[model samples]
Target: MTHSSTAPTDLPVMLPATYRGPDALGYCRWLAAMPVWALPVMAGLVLIWPTLVHAQTVYSTEKIMGIMAKWLPLLITKGFSMNVVISFFTMLLGTIAGLLLGVGRVSDNRYIRGFSWLVVQLFRNSPWLVLLFIVMLTLPFEIRVAGTYFSVPDWMKAVFGLSLPIMANIAEIVRGAIQSVPSAQWEAAESLAFTRRQILWQIILPQCFKRMIPPWMNWYAIMTMATPLVSLLGVTELVTLSRQAMEAEGNNPSLLVPFYGFALIIFFAYCYPIARLTMRLEKKFAVKG
Candidate 1:
């Protein structure tokens, strides 16, 4: 029977191999583990690859670099200063006001609490542009200091306007963080014959610092970004000067993307780290119920 079945011994047949080398198996595993969105991103890159290549070939990369080099210093020197000064003063005033309001919110007197709540609500709910315009239009442009004339700059008005909403938001953050401490903490402090003010200052606030830090940094980053709103008040901030620089570039519509992209990169470079730090802090000091 075996001899009869061996008639086709010389015929060719294909057999599948079951074994793969370590490298092949590893590559397959890595591909399987990749994020679901990776394929779409790769596909998008493939689609845009030709356009990028074409643009690079058609345009002089050196010319674009030259333009960026010319304007970047001016933007940094003139535009950056205005943003920094305004943001600094705004944060300073806002922090002071926010601390006061937060303390008032927790005061024994109902009037103090109501007044603080009113202020927070009034400022927080209003649009920043509206506040900026109101301050710019309504506030006196000049003040006499010790019989000397001093004119208030638009940037100063912008600072005051920006501070109002920040004050309100920070007040809420302060209030919430203070309130998050257990009632047992307050009771324990009271049992030890500690005054309410003493307890709040020495015990509660120290503990609240960890909780407050992340939100404070988050808001600071937001306020820094919002400094561009000062441009509306005629303060020459980063955005305003960016426009001026663009104008100097012969108003070339094609340059819009690059100029704006440069600004975006600058802002991202500054703000992204702060954002990442905030997230890291939030994770570190996350209060378990």
Candidate 2:
């Protein structure tokens, strides 16, 4: 018997199918719940494994300890004495400049806005290295402060050069962070008869700072790492010292690895804790929000 067969087209599938089975979902959730440190540790192990395999012999414990003792003190001193100091001051001045510039950027007055825009555009568009060179070499000699015989010092020149570009970037970050605060919060402050300054100081800036800390810390870390650039102007920071030490150990092929590696470890040691703290603060703030 012949029967006519018809294609069944009762219902169309709506949602795209994905292969997220229960076990897979559970595994993903478990991975997501793991501490952040696990990933970095795993990555480090993966990176170092090849190096370890290729090495002819592992470093002796005593040799490693000797290397650490010789290098660690210098690293600590240089990082704290110069890198940290420069970074802190740079961040502080940058924050202040950025705040003012950002406010000027949003000002209703066209002249103020245009001037700030020009400053931001010029600084932002310029290379930091070139600006650093100009400030250190050219600016003091060429442009004296009006009615003052005292010219800016090379150190101050370096600081200003490094800081201004950072300030321009930070200005945009500050502006965005400020704008991100709820409009309702601003309105509520106004309803309470608060002055602009009072509202900004009391209500807005606190929340903005909380949001800004991570990026601020990141910027500071970068600046701290860049302390070596100061050596170009004869500032003699850690990297300079490392270079000197490397030169002192002339013709020793193995010394370069330990010298530079030790210095790198120092930088990472200084930076990692701050980065972790920033992450914690960000997480806390996220939870609060």
Candidate 3:
């Protein structure tokens, strides 16, 4: 205590208030630079682990092969055609409905706007499964358009049921995108003496379309996956074919796993490339904030 030395009271000295250790600094940099491989690895593990753990010990090679042979032919013939037709019709109807609702959402007319809001609220708030059931099983039985009576074949009804909800969702997306375009753009179109239709189709719609493509692509992919739901309504689509194959397997429950799994794999294989393309389009069209 007696030998202790003290600096002058007024002297300034610099000392670090805090230190970021090298390990901490390196960790932040590592995280920033990390590759995106981890997520895919995790997803693959999650998808594969259940199958591996639950696979039956008494695997019949003939049963597996026979199921594959029977399913593959039908899948290539009827299943493929039905999927393509359903997807096309759904996309067509959804696009038209979305465009009209989107325009109505931004309309100056109160009636049009209110009606659009009501449609969106009614459809969007309901569960898609419920909507499908109503359209397929209940609507035709309950509601008649005229003395002529409107009826849809079960296949067409399935398409309509699946598509209507999707269209409602898409309408909101399109409306939002259109509204997001600068107000100045609308004013410019007006100043140029463009009619409302001209302004919308020429200036706003095109720009909105670029913005809309990503979401539309994603929705299309979802719709493609959802084609299986058509089977519930007696549409002899892919899932229906697979179900029939499973029944043909008779008492062997083990075949159920492979049959369904193979069907799922087949659908995934068809849709995966489309999903990848959509992702690429999303990246390409992403607007800078």
Query: What are the lDDT scores of the predictions, listed in order?
Result: 0.75, 0.67, 0.70
Global CA lDDT of candidate 3, please? 0.70
Lowest lDDT 10-residue stretch of candidate 2: 22-31
Q: Compute each candidate's TM-score over C-alphas.
A: 0.76, 0.68, 0.74
Those runs of model 3 whose alpha carbons end farther than 4 Å from true positions after fitting are: 1-59, 139-151, 287-289
Query: How would you encode candidate 2's per-residue C-alpha lDDT over 1-289 as one tens digit per residue?
Result: 1334443653434433445533312222333355667545654553453345445535443444465467658766864367667767778888899888877776668998899889888886587778878777776544446865775555566687789887987777677778889889989999999987788778887888877766676667666767668767765567667677656545344455555665565566666666666666667876776
Q: Which candidate do you rate higher for TM-score, 1 or 2?
A: 1
The number of the candidate with the highest lDDT is 1
Off by over 4 Å in 1: 1-62, 287-289
- Cα displacement (angstroms), candidate 3, residue 143, comes to 13
Q: Report the lDDT tens digits of candidate 1 across residue range 74-139.
A: 888888777878888998999889988988889889999999999999998699889888988998
Q: Which numbered prediction scores highest in TM-score against the true structure?
A: 1
* Overall local distance difference test of candidate 1: 0.75
Candidate 3 structure quality by residue, lDDT tens digits, 75-101:
757775687688888888988997899
Q: Which is better, 2 or 3, measured by lDDT?
A: 3
